[model samples]
Target: MLSPVSTDSNHHPLNGTDATEHSVGADLPRAIATLNEEETYRALLTATHWATLDHAYGSAAEAPKRLAELLAQDQTVRTKALDYLHYTLHHQNTLYEATAPAALYVAAILPNPRTTRTVDKGHNSFPGCMRAELLLWIASVADAVTDEADVLSRRHGFPLDDYPPAVSIRRIRPQLYSAAVAYVDDTDRPTAEAAITACIRLLDDPRLLHHRAALVPGIRQILGTSEQWQHRERAIDALDTWGEDSTGLEGQQNPFLFCDSDTPTDNGSRPIDTNEGYSEPPPF
Candidate 1:
């Protein structure tokens, strides 16, 4: 589902000077290792923000190669690389690798939940702060989408700021569609239905108003169910925003037993399991 960003894969749109020089290349591994010490880690995090804002493309291009180099000598460096790569992806929207031939393969090599470990430092640390901010952004956007484009914009329910800006919502729209389709097919009807319901909620996110074409078709799946009441209301709100159907009744009981409110209301319901586009308990 990830689309090619630019027609020209042979050329980079913009280039920056590579400041980190490895003269011998042979001594690069040892040098990078030495650079990863505590002070360097803090510097890296500080550098991350500036790189994200000003030089995202360069950082995204550089992080993976540096990661592979560091991973070869000491696996722990993978942690640092992953953190930086995540930052690049969230900010720059650059591909994992610059070359067309290596894009898919490199992307697949990304560590998922299985391989990637969360970097936590007590209650407050740079990475920790980043994670919290990223989560908040995701929650905000997810609560704002209005249709398929919004869902696409939100990157299949993942928050926009948590990933590199180089990877656009449009690029991954097909994957999001496939994921939703798969969610509907799973044997557990209620769970599958609930996920579809969540998709409706995602589209209702206010941030996605401009992308109505991508969101309207999925509305039929979310209509008239107490189970998905809140999502239904949001969907209705989105529909209203688009001048489709914007009316709401007070004290309506949602079939899914969800609370009715524009703001997020966590009722402590069962967790949604959305892997492989099917219904199953989360891998808790």
Candidate 2:
């Protein structure tokens, strides 16, 4: 589940490093359409010493290259890059020092028209856009730092805030949310649902509760028609936790299809469908 929505919906704990901004009167979102995508790719590489950080396999030296590869003209090259992000940087829903930093770049690239036209692998029909892959990959990272993640970290020795990577991940919520929220109304049905899922997960930080007010109707719209039952249920759970009225927003019954039940996962879950989450099959 998500972090319990702060009891005081208005209680934004902007303490030391946890300070989230109360600056916006109305939420404004960002998209790649508004950005220079080439500059974004370059900045991700130069933004940090990626090798200095760690991912599942070891030094995150490959993080920058893989992220750059996401934009390659060859579809296979791009899909492989996304696969690397899934299995390594945010491997099995575990966060690495590189995961959060790399995630910021991931957030920066949404609404790229190229990915929006691509279908993910394994689905023969109307599969989601490649942006869904990026959204859910970010979802995996955000899920790793929820209050639930806190339990795991405490078991190992530290609370999430004290963990360097978790703290970094928490600090970037607004940026990630910006990327997701802008897509909630996407024309692609699955893409809209994926965006809704991303927003709910990111709002676990009390500072983002304010966004709930604006998202309710759009969420209801997506879930209303969503066949992705697991993701749909989790989104409803998040709404209820935040004290929103989920009156008719219940999910589809269980015995869901393999991909439907296996997708929209959380906190270490690699939904069987998740492997198919990133790329559409190539045409002969």
Best of the candidates, lDDT: 2
Model 1, residue 89: distance off in Å is 12
Error of 2 at 256 (Å): 8.7
1-284 per-residue lDDT for model 2 (tens digits)? 12212221221112222112332111113224344657645754565667788887789887878887776777767767777787777765667788876776777667566666453443343344578777777777788777767888898888887777787778677767777787787777766777777787787776887778787777676754577667667767776877777777657675544545334454323344433543332121
Off by over 4 Å in 1: 1-167, 185-190, 198-223, 242-284
lDDT of 1 at 54: 27
Q: Each candidate's TM vs. the true structure?
A: 0.30, 0.76
TM-score of 2: 0.76
